[model samples]
Target: MGKANDVQFERARPRIWDRLYPYLSILPALIIIALFTVYPFVYAVRISFFQNLLTKPRSHPFIGLQNYEEVISSYYFRSALTVTALYAIAVVLGVLIFGLGVAMLLNSNIRLANGLKIIILLPWAIPTVVAGLMWKWILNSDFGILSGILYSFGLISSYIPFLANPTLAKISLVMAHIWKEGPLAAIFFLAGLQLIPKELYEAAKIDGGGGWRLFRNITLPLLRPIILIVIVYETMTAILVFDLIYVMTGGGPADSTALLSWFAYAEIFKSLNLGHGVALAIIIALITLVLILIYLRLLKTEEINV
Candidate 1:
């Protein structure tokens, strides 16, 4: 009887090991993720409740929601919110228009379509910081390639300071953002366009549907999912934009381009107030989360309606 029990126990041990093998295989990755992602997020949240100032680093008193209150009540917060909203709206709209246009053009059997398709994604391939630097150089007040081209054509009496004036700076920033982000959106749209059945378009044409009619009815409806995705993604990107501002505008020319993320950076490094920065960052994250949730709810309703 004892020998039989020992053999049964050994068999059960293998079964238990098999059950835990999958979890053990992924344990290392779980540990790494916790250490990097989870730990930092928790730490940031904790830091936001303290008085973490470089000037008084020796005393980090518990401040509760004071950091959040001070940051929210400031004038800079209002300005940053406004700028961020405008920038997000403009960039999302511009990217959608530009992307849809490019995608439609690529889908058509136009001359050099293949070549254009290959070249169009180059901007998206470049790093955001590098793209911003490139744009900065192109729009430089003096001796910029764009200014040189315009001067050569006698379009302006003098080279325009694209980054100096508040309005021009905002426009230039928007243009740069569209150029950098439009390519991915175009690719997304193109993929959606390709998935659409040719038969649908053919039938619409047979039913006397012209280009605009077919697009308004068939193309738009079919591409609704892709459009929503692009909107959400572009909105997030626009809200969190920092590298471009850092490289191109530095939130300058009278703070016309100082976005919320830029203010967060300023609070942390420039103002040397870690608690304020963390709180602002948390606010930004919450704003993004709320927007995403709203988008997801709309998407669900859309799916249900369809």
Candidate 2:
């Protein structure tokens, strides 16, 4: 009986290893992720409920959710939150609408279409920091190319500070975002557009469907998945915007352009409030999760309909 049991155990050991081999191959990546992403996340959550002295080490007290309450109640946080929400919405809408228009244009067999596409893709290919810097130069109040052009056209009497004023700062940031992401969005839309059957358009034409009608009936329905993906990506990108604002406004003019990411960063590094920063970071993560959940729900509905 002992010999028989030993043989069975030996056979099962190899079978178990065979079953687990694939997972074992990915174990290193899983370990790295746990060490970096998961550890930091857990640490942040722990610190969010603590009162930590930034300048002094090894001094922290558990304070429940007071940091969250303080961050929520602050006027600076409230205003920045509003600006962040508006910035996300505006950038997403502008990128989608403008990108769709550009995609439609590129889909046509126009002259220099490839060249145009290459030019359009420049923004997406450019490093974000470089793009922000270039725009800062162009949007500078005194000697910016745009300011010069506007001056040449006699649009305004004095130089307009695009990044100085709160309203103008938001507009400038949105414009930068559109320039950076529009081409990427167009590429996605173009891919979706190609998958749409040419026969569908022909059929629509046979039924006396005009351009608008065909687009409304066929193009939109077919492109819903790509559109949803773009929306999700754009939303997350906009919410987490930091580079543009950092380069352009520096979250200045009384923190007008302070997005949630920037807000958390400012709290941690600038103000040296680790606890408050961690709390804000957690809030940002939660908001992002909520947005993702909404997208997943919509995706599920679309799948069910299909």
The number of the candidate with the highest lDDT is 1
Pairs with backbone N, CA or C atoms under 3 Å apart (clashes), candidate 2: none
| lDDT digits (tens) for residues 1-306 of candidate 2 | 255568878787889899999999999999998899988888889999998759867888889999999888866787878888999999989999988888888888998777787788889998888889999999999899998998999998788898889888889889999999989999999999988889999988999999999989998899899899999999999988888878878897778788888988888888899988889888988999999999999999998998
Give model 2 RMSD, 1 decimal.
4.3
- RMSD per prediction, one decimal? 3.4, 4.3
Give the lowest summed-lDDT range of ten residues in model 2: 1-10
lDDT score of model 2?
Answer: 0.89
lDDT for each residue of candidate 1 in 1-306, tens digit (9 for 90 to 100): 255578878788889899999999999999998899998999999999999998897999999999999999988999999999999999999999999999999999989889999899999998999999999999999889999999999999899999999999999999999999999999999999999999999998999999999999999999999999999999999999999999999998889999999999999999999999999999999999999999999999999999
Q: Which stretches of candidate 2 lie over 4 Å from their true place?
A: 1-20
Q: So what's the TM-score on candidate 2?
A: 0.91
